[model samples]
Target: MQPHVTTALQAWIASWTAHERAAQDVMEAAFPGLKPTPAPTGCCDVQMRWERDGEGSGTACLDDHGRATIQFEDVPKAAVGHAMTEVFGNGWFNEGPDGFAGAPPGKYCWEDDCTYAECEIDIGDDGLAAVAISYVKIEDVVAILDALETGLEAVRPSA
Candidate 1:
């Protein structure tokens, strides 16, 4: 059953790419500076065992909640966090953009219900942020970003 769901998600994403250019255009229109990159890795397979990326790169699957977060070193968690929030749920951080609570700071925390979720990848004392390229609903991403664009606050990458 779960495998079928995963298969369906993959098929959906693949189909998305067929007309992805259009989606990209939409995403671009929403967040002009930000770009949606191809997912470097896909769903977990046999080779994707749960483990730490000792070299500062690794993937962690919070399967119980139907989500995963891949950590990266020196990747500017805040920048990514703000970008994701602005893109998905307005500029909601620490809490939601519109009174919607943001995901708490930590390694990614998949929600209990597993409906719409997010994860934070802590960048030291800064705060918890996301790990992956981030998987979010297309419409949500677009709506939130459109709002954020109106209130741009350029975040300089961590030095």
Candidate 2:
């Protein structure tokens, strides 16, 4: 069976529940091909949070200007950031409710537009693997997705 959107969503939520070692495990568990390295200090930071039907996770790096530039990578380690972020990187990575709470500590609110949510997973040379989900309620789409573009933006990393 194909991987479900909720499954991916849950996997993202579940990653924060685990300890450091366990976070590595959760990372490995979420992506079969992931290769994680110790996150260098000042290089990367993580944020995780979860809620009922609406939940999300993201990572934001500190820019040269000391500003936080939020970006989404396919793998937790972002080993293939060039590829993954390119396919799925149009989000603000908010600060409340599973938005971005530093090392992705616990519980968060999911922000994304509902009705029709979409994100493309990059699979290297095979092109992009698409993940699109439709909802009966428009609020589900709005509240969950928050009208975030699933496309990669050129200003920074992938879309």
Candidate 3:
């Protein structure tokens, strides 16, 4: 590659690294037991693995765009609704005759043009819930972590 191209590539990688480090630092502070996990090859996201003794384990990733996704495995089915409500707010789940009808499990933006932050939640059959929250500002990372922590608390049994 040309010298200029190489320099640009290096800068791009550096930006991703910086963002990842910042996000990781925040996570580590919030969850002291969090350990670094290998990110997917060629992916721009930073991944971390965390465990709550006798509770459960989860993985968190921060993408280049500062979007953080936390996936909790083996969560209680009963807690899923409360977790969703905690993160997405009340009325996020639609009511139906049979029971609550969940919103589609995929990405969506708060605004029509998507200029604002994006969010998504996917609940799997095996009781794994992956929640993705995007941030328009770096400081919002704290809020994202708080929301995830709150949801996790709802999922875990009380000490």
Candidate 4:
């Protein structure tokens, strides 16, 4: 990962140690070889990338003065879909009643006070999908990542 991205991700992760720790357990359970970078103080952002055997690859990033962004390139569509359903409840992503076959990508957004967050699912050319979450508030960032972590855990076996 680039230095700036690394710093950004560090900051973001550091800011959410409690949530990060819980997610770490989920991540470890799902992908044993994967390791997360420590979040030290003065870290300005959350930007890093990693890949592990038996697990997929992804990037987490944020600029010095912007919202946090995460992308899991090789994530299993089913796992992420299940996570989204669990996190946001039903009716969040409109894939029709039949499910993903002809469903377009899902998009959802919400705001609370001064913070805003957006979640999306991007389908790659390989027919696999990646989950991307961006948010401004620290809580939203944690919630998004936690949902992802929980979601990934939910689907780890099949993945």
Whole-model lDDT values for every prediction: 0.42, 0.30, 0.56, 0.56
Regions of model 2 farther than 4 Å from truth: 1-18, 39-42, 45-159
Best by TM-score: 3
Q: Residue by residue across 79-149, what tens digits does model 2's lDDT show? A: 22232233333233232232221212222122236423233232223321222222213222222222233
Ranking by lDDT: 3, 4, 1, 2
Higher-lDDT candidate of 2 and 4: 4
Q: How do the residues 1-159 of candidate 3 rate in per-residue lDDT, one tens digit apiece?
A: 999999999999898788779788887776555678774624435778777753357766676667665555544433544544544565533422221124333332342145465555455555454544454344554555555466556656666
For each candidate in turn, the TM-score is 0.37, 0.22, 0.54, 0.53
Query: Judged by lDDT relative to the true structure, which candidate is superior, 2 or 3?
Result: 3
lDDT for residue 114 in candidate 1, whole number 0-100: 55
11-78 in candidate 1: lDDT tens per residue? Answer: 98777555445545665576555443334436532112122222123333222222333333443344
Clashing pairs in 4: 5-47, 7-45, 8-45, 8-46, 8-47, 9-45, 9-46, 9-47
Mind sharing the TM-score for model 1?
0.37
Q: What's the C-alpha lDDT at position 122 in model 4?
A: 67
- The TM-score that candidate 2 achieves is 0.22
lDDT of 4 by residue, 1-159 (tens): 999999999987677765545544543444343455556422433445667443467766554544555667676666555556655655555655533323455443333445556666765555457666765444445555566566566665663
Instruction: Supply candidate 2's per-residue lDDT for 158.
Output: 35
